[model samples]
Every structure is written in C-alpha cells, then in structure tokens.
Target: MLMHSVSGVLIILVLIATGYWLTVQGWFDEHYSKITSKLVTQIALPCYMINTITTQFTRGHLLKILPDLQFPILSMTLLFGLSYLVQWFFQIDPHHRGLFKSMFANSNTVFVGLPVNMALFGKASIPYVLVYYMANTTFFWTLGVYLIRSDGQTHPGFNLWQIVQKIFSPPLLGFMMGIVLVCLQIKLPPFVESDLHYLGNLTIPLSMFFIGMKLAQMGLRNIRPSKDMAGIFLGRFLLAPILMTILVLPLTVPNLMKAVFIIQSAMPVMTNAPVVAKLYHADSNYAAVMVTATTCFSLIMVPLLMMMVMRLV
Candidate 1:
C-alpha cells in the first residue's frame, strides 16, 4: 500500500517537475498552457463525460440511483462546510472566504480522478465516475459562482439560464447528447465506441500533463504556502475524503461505486476555485496555494487512501 502510494505521488511529481523544466527552458509558453487547458475542458473532458453518461443513463440505468445520490451529495456538502469552517477558523479575510469555500467543495475530477480510477479499479468504473462528475459540474459552477460574489458586488442575479448554459457547455452537452442517444436507443456502432474508448483514454495523461503545465506556470517561486493554504490542502486531500469514506464505504454501495466516490473525494482542489477567486476579487493567492499543495499531496494521499478503502471493504 505504501509503495503504491509512493509510486502514485512520484509519478505526479515527476510530471510536474518535467513541466516546470520545460517551461523554464521555454519549451512551451503560457499560450501553450492555455490552449492545453482549453482543449481538455472544451473538447476532451466533455466528450469523455458524454460518452460515459450516454451509457449510464440508459433505460434501466437512470432509475437505479435512488440511494446512490445520497452519499455523493452528503459528501460534497460535508466537504463544503469543512472548507468554509477552515476559512472562519483561520480568520481568512472576508474576501478570501469564497475562495476557501471553493477549494473545499471543488475537486480535481479530471486529471487525478481518471488515472486513479483506472489504476485502482479499472476501465469499467469510468462511466460511473463520469456521472458523478457531470453532477458535480453543475453544482460547482452554479452554487460556487454564487458564493464568490462579495462586498456588494452585484450578484450575477440568479440565472437558471446560466446554469443551463453551463450544463450545455461543450463538455456537459456531450453528456446530454449521450443521454439523448441512450433514450433514442441508438447504439454507436462498435467502431465508434472503439474510437471513443481510444480517445477517452487520452483524457488521463493529457489532463495530467495539463496539471503539469499549470504547475509550471505557477512554479514554486510564485507560491508561498501559508497555514490557511495548508488547511485547504489537508481538508481536500486528506480530511474531506476520509470523512466521506467512513460514511459511504460502510453503506451497501457496490465496491466500484464506493471506490469512485471515495477516490473522487480524494482528488485535489478543483482548478475552478482559483478562477472563481480571481473573478470575485477574493484571495486568489490562497486559492493558488490550495491548488498547488493539494495537487502535490494528493499523489500520495489518494493511492494510500484507496488501498485502505480496498482493504476495509
């Protein structure tokens, strides 16, 4: 277990180190990183998510989640509170609290979630995870956006259309199209599914490399890890998932579902947290620290936590 954890951590660190070196060496510019993140978010993530959702939301699949949504929601909400609690305890400025809230609730669902799942469970678990992420996307963009508006900033005025816009955003639209395909009972020819499988698999490494690129852009020099930052790291990487695992694993969740939920929770703070922080004039630095520390730490924490969960189950 320890070895597995160490290997996972080392791989991620090496990727980051390589990325850092490449940027320092001027192999890629910030424009390159932006394009990479854009491709992942606008193209790769949506396609993979749509492919998974189409398969899972089929005739019999949609109604089967009666009890399943509970744990995910509970876990998400719990982590949300814990993250906010940290901000309050730390006495982070009112401005930064929103960023802290995002760190607690958002997670690295793509880069870390995909690779870790394939390593710990298998390709079969990917569809279930896609659903979880699809749902998470909605919550993160909507409620998360709302939280960051502060100091009498004109609230973007609650807009359901905006939420729908997020859902219909390229990545999510793919998932929606998948659902339509499933409902229409149109199976992709074997060749297409095969193509999807091949393309979808690229999600893992590409996303990881994107993380590497972001870390390179931030680098160690730009980020000074503060105690408040450390708290967000611990909360996301260690504490929140640990709390979720205890609640979800003991329930009758299938081993695969349990693994997905637990591992997803274990992912690093969501990249959007910082974006939202910057948007609302919150503590973007704190959000950046949360991103860096959690990204660095989750390499070890995720695998070790997975091993423990597997053993307990």
Candidate 2:
C-alpha cells in the first residue's frame, strides 16, 4: 500500500491540531515548552538511549557498525556545506546567513526520525539512529553555533568543556554508563533492567507530544505563508533530501537503513535553528519562517520522499 506517506502526514496533522488547541487554550507557552524541552534533553531522552543501547551493545554488534557511522557524519557535513552554498549563491542577507546555513543544518533525528524508523524498521535500528544523533548534536553545538555568530568582531570560541558537558548530560551520561557496562560485560539485575525499560519507553511518545505542544504554542497564524520564504523551503524540504538520496543510493547501504536515512534527511528544518539564530544574532525571523514553511510542507513532502526511498531501497 502507498499508505506510509499517508500515515506520516495524518500523524503530523493530528499533532499540529493538538499543538494548535494547546496554544489556543493557553496551555503551552514558552515557559512550559522550555520546561518540557529540559525534561526531554535532560532526563527522558538519555534514559531511553541508555536503556536501549545497553541491551544491544555487544562487542560483535559494535564491530558491525564500525564503518557505518561515517555515513551519517558525511551526510550531515554535506548538508551543512549545501546550506552554506545556497545562502551564498542566493545573496541572502548577511544577517540572515547564519539562520540560512542552519536552516538545512540539523536533522530532526529525535522528534520525527526515531519513531518513524522504529515503527517501520523495529528496535534493531535504534542504535544506528542514536549514533546518527550523536553526530548531529555534536556539530550543532560547536560548528553550528560558531557559523551563526560570524558577524561578531572577535573570532568565535570553541568551549571544549562546555561541549563535553553537553555530551555528559544526565541522559547522555546514562547512555555512556550503559555502553561502558556493556563493553565491560556487566549485566544488570533483571528488576533493575525492567525499571530502565519502563522509564525509557516513556521517551518517544513524550517527545512527540511535546512537538505537538510546540506547534500549539507557535500558532498557525504565525505560519502565514509568504513567497519570500520559498527559497529556504525549496532548499531544505526539497533539495536537501533529494541530494541525500542521490548521494546515498550508491553507497551500498541496506535498503531499510537507506529508507530511514533519506526520511531523516528530508525532515523539516530543526525547531532549534531559530533558537540558534537568536542566540547568535542571526536573522531569527527568517529562521522561524524557514522552519514554519518546511514543517508545514513536510505534511506533503516527507511522506512522498519516504515512499520513493522505500521503493528504491
């Protein structure tokens, strides 16, 4: 059936409405969303990563993917370069350059990527998905931040410790601890393992629901479409994913992994792009508009792209 795309669209629309209702009712505002994002980044996401990876990280398993990590890193780097080139070629406002670069920057690996992949590809793909996230987030905090702030008189600084601190976050720390235990061949007692599973399972749904809540807070009126925004829309939601498909198809990736990869590639610009823009003095409004347009268009574009990738794979 041609329903994978349909299903994805339907699910996102439902989430959009849920977000809209929440915002209209004043249930989710910036303060609330910040708190929720904290929970996701601080606790739930890490717990899920730890629990999921620990159970799967055998020595042999790690060995299998020793080379596959490069695909995601390469994919992300390519996307970043593509974004920069597009911004330069278009002569986009110098102020908007940072956001423009970031628009196609990070993949929505957590919110949209994991659930869809899990549903379609099962639990086996989770570790690979997480590995992809490690690369994306690493680039986002370091290179991403610097690029967005290029206008400052002083040169950009890399706070290695701060970046490391982000990596060693509670959730991330837990994940690392889990990996260590697996490498050391220490098994958790059955009850403790079960508890981990219980807490970890809460992650995906909460993240998705929070994405819905964010949409509500942002409101549809804020999403009023404009032709000025089309370049970003076309570049991110269309061109970037297609570029991914072309680049990846010849790489000898598994069909299913390829499907997951392309869908991740095709996702709307990250919600965090605007956040990065604001923090770095980029054109936050342009970033927001790009985010809005790509996201709304994803209701149409992502599913179709997924379907095409699925067939090719």
Task: Give the top-scoring candidate (TM-score).
Answer: 1
Pairs of residues at least 3 apart in sequence or in different chains that clash in candidate 2? 19-216, 46-171
Instruction: List model 1 lDDT by residue over 1-313, tens digit each.
Output: 4454345456655665676677778887767765665565566656676567665566566656534766767777887777776777888766666666766777776556766776666678776676567656656755565565442254546478754653355555666677678767888888777676666655655555555555566666767757667667767777767777788766766777877887787788775554444444555445655666777777667657776667643
Instruction: Tell me each candidate's RMSD, in Å, in order.
Output: 4.3, 4.4
Question: Candidate 2 at residue 169, lDDT?
Answer: 49
Candidate 1 residues lying further than 4 Å off, grouped into runs, are: 1-11, 55-58, 93-96, 122-131, 145-168, 188-210, 253-256, 271-289
lDDT of 1: 0.65
Least well predicted 10-residue stretch by lDDT in candidate 1? 149-158
RMSD of model 1, in Å? 4.3
Once superposed on the true structure, which residue ranges of model 2 sit more than 4 Å away at CA? 90-100, 115-134, 137-175, 189-218, 226-232, 271-292
